[model samples]
Target chain A: MSKIKVENLTKVFGKQKKRALQLLKEGQTKKDILEKTGCTVGVNQANFTVEEGEIFVIMGLSGSGKSTLVRMLNRLIDPTSGSVFIDSEDISKVNDDQLRQIRRKTISMVFQRFALFPHRTVLENTAYGLEVQGIPKNKREDRAMETLQMVGLKGYEHQLPSQLSGGMQQRVGLARALTNDPDILLMDEAFSALDPLIRKDMQDELIELQSAMQKTIVFITHDLDEALRIGDRIALMKDGVIVQIGTPEEILTDPANEYVERFVEDVDWSKVLQAENVMKRAEMITLDKDGPRVALNRMRETGLSSLFAVDRRNRLQGVLSADAAKQAIDEGKPLADLIERDIVKVRPDTLLNDIMVQMAETNHPVAVVSDDDRVRGVIVRGSVIGALTGKEVKTHD
Target chain B: MTESIPKLPLADVVEVIVSWLQANVGWLFDFISNLIEPTVAFFTAVLMFLPTLVTIVLIAALTWWLSSWRIALFTLIGLMLIANLGYWEESAQTTALVLTATVISIIIGVPIGILCGKNDTARNIITPILDFMQTMPAFVYLVPAVIFFSLGTVPGVIASVVFSMPPTIRLTNLGIRQVPEDLIEASDAFGSTSSQKLFKIQLPLAKTTIMAGINQTIMLALSMVVIASMIGARGLGEAVLTAVQRIEVGTGFEAGLAIVIIAIVLDRLTQNLGQGNGQHPRN
Candidate 1:
C-alpha cells in the first residue's frame, strides 16, 4: 500500500501565493517568481508516493526546499495548492480536526535540531506524542519506556534533552516519533546536526530500526552520503523541484542531469559501489571435471594469480592459486587436492568498503557468490584500486 | 506666534468623551467598583484584623515557603521595622492594594498577551496601543478613573491597573513569541491543538519570563500607590500626604521609609517565584 502520496504539492511563502503559483505553473524559475511576485517558492510542484515500509530519502542542498517538502507531508505548512494523501486520505483537503487526527494516528516527525522539549525529561519527551493524543498516563509511559529503551536510552529516562549529547538527544527525538506508532515517519534533517561519526552511527541505527519496525519513512537531508546509506530510494532535488529519484546504484551510476552528476561527484565510491558493481566475472575450474592442467593453463593465459574452484553446478567450492595449481601438476595431484577450501567468499551485495577489509585479511581474491553458493563475480586487488580511483566502475564479463 | 495646527482641541475632546462615558456607563462603573471594592476590602480587613506580630510571622513563613530562608529573614526584619515605626496599618493597606492590582493585571493581561503573541495582526494592532498606555504620564489616568469610580481605593486601583498592566502584557507576549520556533513546530507536528500547544509547550517554556513580568507588575503597582493617593485612597501615601501638609519631616520620613521596606519585601517575594523548577537542564 502507498502510505503517502503527494500530488502536485506546492508551497509558496508570503502574501502573493496565488500569483506565485500562477507564475510557477507558467514555468517561471523560483528566483524569477520571487522577483516578479515577491514570493519565495518553498516547494514547487512536488509529486511522489511512498510505499509501505520503504525509506524514501529526499536529498538536496540548502535552499533546495527538501525541508519544506517534508514539512508539507504532515501538513506542518499548509500547501498553497496541491494535495497530500496519507493512507489514501487527501490530507490537504482535510479540515483542521481531521488533519490533526491524521497527524496523531498516521504520521509523526523527527526534527533536525533534536526538538525534544528541553523542559521535558527523556521519558516525558518520548511520551509527548501519546500525551497529545490523550492516552492514559500509565499506558503512554509504558509505551514510551519501551521506545526509549529501544533507542538505547534506558537509563537516561529522567534526564532532560539538553543534558544529553546531540546524538543522544536525537535518539529521544526519534523515540518520541516512534511512540505514536504511526505508519509514516518524517525525519527532517534528523541526523544533519550531529558530527560525522555520530551521524554514521545514527544512520546505521535508523536503518536497523526501520527493518525491525517497517515504518514508511520520509527522510530529508543535505548529505548525499547519509541519504544513500539509509535510503531505499533517493529523490534528488534542486531549487524547490525534484530532479530525479532512483536507487542508490542507479543514482551513483546513472545521474539524470548535470546537477545530479555534480551533486554526487564527491560521494565515496567505496561506500556506494557494491561487490556486484565493482566485481569481474569470475573464472573457475569445475572441480569435478577440470584437471590441474586446465587450471594452470587458464591461469597462464589470463595472467591471473588464482582461480576459483567450483562444483559442476557452478557452486563455489574453493580457490586454486597459481602456486598450488603448479605444485599440483608437478606432484600429479587432482584439482580437488590443490583447491584451498578456506578462502573467504562474499555475497554480491557486499559493499566495496567491506570487501577492502576482507581483501586485507587474506592473500586470496574475494569471490562474489549468490545466496545459493554460485560464483557470480570476483574482486581482485587491481579491480578494487581501479574502483576506488575511478568515477565509474565498468563491470567486465 | 499663533499655532498653525489650531491647537487640536485634544483636551476638550477627551473631556467630552469622558463625560459621555460617565453618563451612559455610570451603573456599569458602580458595578465594577462593587466587585473590586469588596475583594480589596476583604483582603485589607483580614490583614487589619490580624495582630501585627501575627501577620508579620505569617508573611515571613509564606516567604520562607515560596523562597529561601534568606528572603524570609529579610521580610521578617523589614515588616518588624515597619511595625516598629508606628505605620503598621498603612503598610497593611499598601500591601493589600498592591496585591489586588497585581492579581487584576495578571487576570486581564495574560490572555490578551497570548492573543497578541499568536496572531501577527493582533500584535500589530495592540503594540501601538500598549505604547500609548505605557508612554502616557502616570498621573493623567487619574481624571477618567475618578470620573468612573468617583474616588477611593477603587479609582486608585483602576489607575494602577492601567499603569502597571503594560509590562505584564508586553513581557507575556515576548516570552511566548521567544519560545524556540522548532519547539512550536514540534508541537504542531505532533498533532497538538493550539490550546494544547499553548498550555503544554509555549507556556511552560515561557514561565520564567512571564514570572518576571508579574514581578515587574507588582513593583510598578507599588510605585503607583503614592500617586494613587491623590484621590481618596488610604495607605502609607495618605500618611506621607498628611506629613507634607504639616511640614513634619520626621513623620514623612517614617511613612516614606515604611513604603520602601514594603516595596523591598514584595520585590524579593515575587522575584523568587520563578526559581528551582528544573527549568534549565542540569549541567
Candidate 2:
C-alpha cells in the first residue's frame, strides 16, 4: 500500500455543507456552488497516492485548496466526504484517540508560518511534542537538542522564537516536528515564507535531510518553481481540484491541462530541468568490438554527424566524427584509433541551461555521463535551445 | 408612551432575585463572608502590626525588586510623605484591602477567562454578564453586597471584587483569542491535549495581557474600596469619608493625596510585572 492515499477526498466550509456538496456533485464550479449555497468548497475530489519516501508536492496559487487537502490527511480539518488512508488505515475514519496516536507517532507537520510559539524558548518549543507525550523534561530536552542541532540551531536553544531570524525560527519548527521522530512528515509550504536565497538553501537542506532520513514528506507550495526544485512527484492543484500528478519533468514538459500549463509556463526551467530530462538516447559504436567500417556504416545509416564510442561495459571513452570515421576508414585503422578525446562531457544531473554553453564549441553530441563513467544519454546544441523554449529543434547538420 | 410597554418589571425582578438570594442562600453568603472577612482583616492586621518605617521600607524594597529604582524611590518618598501626613496606617489598610480584593478576583477570573477563550458558547454566555458587571453602576453592587453579607469589610470586599474583575476576564479572553491562528493550529497539529495547549501555549502567550488586566483590576479595586467605606469598611477610605463628612478640607486633601500615592505605586508595580518579561512581541 502507498504511504498516503487520498481517495475522492473533499471538504466544504460553511453551514450549508450538504447542499454545497450536492451542488458540487452536480458539476458546479467552486464559485457557482459558493454563489448558490454560500458554502465554499475547500477541496473537491482531490485524489492521489504518495509512495513511501518521496517528496509529493501539492502546488497551486492561494485558495486552490492545497492547504486544505494536506490538513485533511491529518484530520486537522475533517473531510466532508471520502477517505485518507495512511499505511492502509483509514485516517479519515479514525476515532479521536486513534487519530491522536497517529498524529503523535506517525505523522508530524511543519507549517508555512513557522508557527513557533513566541513565548517559548527554542529548546522548549522543540521539546513540546515530546513534553505533550508526558516524557520527562531532561529526556525530551536531550532529544530536542539533538534535533535542533540537526537543523543547525545548536547554540540558540535558549533563545525565544521572536529573537531568531525567519530562517532560524523555521529550523526550530522543523526540529519540533522532528523531535517526535514521526514517519510521515507534512510540510505545508515550509520554505515559502523565507527570503528567496534562504528558501533555496532550505530546499537544498531539506533534500539532503530527506536522503538520510527517508521519511515520506508531503510538501505543499504555491510556487511551481519550488515544487519542481524538491518534489520527486508533484500534484498540481487548481480551484479545489488536483489537475495533474507527475514527476517535475513530466509536469513541465507535458502539463495535463491549461491550468497546469500556466503554472509551469513562467517557471525558471534552468533551475529544475536536468540534463537527463532533455537528453536523447546516445547512439554509440563499441570502442574495441566495432572497427572503422562499423562506425562509418552506423553513422551513414543513422544520418548522424558523430557518435559516442563506449566500451563493452557502456563506459564512454570518446567521440568519432563522420569525417574522422571516413579518415579512419581510408587509413584502414580501428574505431579506438580515430576516437576524438576533445568531445564535451557532462554529468547526467547537470542543468540543461549549463549544457548549452558546453555544447557551443563541439560539433559532436554532448555526452551525459554518470559518476561511474557510464554513458547515460547525449544532448545536441539545437536540442538544448529547443528544450528551453519548449519546441522541437532540427538536428545540427 | 404611557402604557405601551407596560413598564417592564426589570427593577422588581432584580429586587426579588436579591431578596430570594438573601432569604434562601443566607448561609452560603455567611460562609463566604466568614471566609473572606478574616482574610482581608488578616492582611490589614499584618500591615498594622509592622512599624510604619518597616512597612514603608519593605514596600520600597518590593517595588524596587518588581520594577525600577526610580519607581521604588517614588514609592519610598510617597509613603514617607503619607506617613508625615498622619495617614500611614489608613493607607496600609487600604493597600491591604486592594491586595485582598485583587487576589480573589484573579483566582475567580482567570479560569473563567480561559473557559471563555476556548469555548465560544461560554464566551457568548459570559460576555453579556461581563457587560452587565462592568457597565452597571458601581453603587448598584454595594446594595446586593450589603444585603448578602450584611455590613462591614465583608460587603466592602465583595463589592470591590464585583467592581474590579471584568478587565481580567476581558483581557485574558482577548489575549487568548488574539494568539495567531497558525500557532493554535501548530499546537493542535502536534496532538496536544487541551490542557497542554493552554498551559504551554495559551497562558504564557496571554500573560502580558492578563497582567495588564490585573493592573487595571488593582486600580479598580482601590477606587471601589474607597467607595466601600460608606458600608462601614475601614482604612484611608474611612478617613477620607470622615473628613469629607465634617467638611474638613485639609484632612480630606491629605487622605486623597495618600490614595493617589498608593494608586501610583500599585499601578507601576503591576505594570512592570508584565513588561519585565523581556520577550520581543511577535505576531
Best by TM-score: 1
DockQ of the candidate models in sequence: 0.74, 0.64
Measured over the true interface residues after superposition, the C-alpha RMSD of each candidate is 1.5, 2.0
What are the per-residue Cα lDDT tens digits for candidate 2 across B91-120?
Answer: 877888899899999999998998899889
lDDT of 1 by residue, B90-199 (tens): 88788888888989999999989999889999999999998999899999999889988988999999999999998899889998999999999999999999999999
lDDT of 1 by residue, A280-323 (tens): 87888998888878888998889887899999899998999888
Error of 1 at A333 (Å): 2.6
Native-vs-model 2 lDDT? 0.88
- What are the models' TM-scores? 0.96, 0.94
Clashing pairs in 2: none
**Residue A382 shift from truth in candidate 1, angstroms:** 1.8
Q: Candidate 2 residues A1-397, lDDT tens each?
A: 6999988899999999999888888889999988888898999988899999999999989999999999999988999998999999999888888888898889999999999988778999999889888999999999999999999999999898888999999999999999999989999999989999999899999999899999999999998878888999999888998889988878877788887888777877767667877788888988878887787788788888789999999998998888888888788777687788877888977876677777777677889999988998888766677767866522211
State the RMSD for candidate 2.
3.1
Look at candidate 1 and tell me the lDDT of residue B151: 85
Docking class of 1: medium
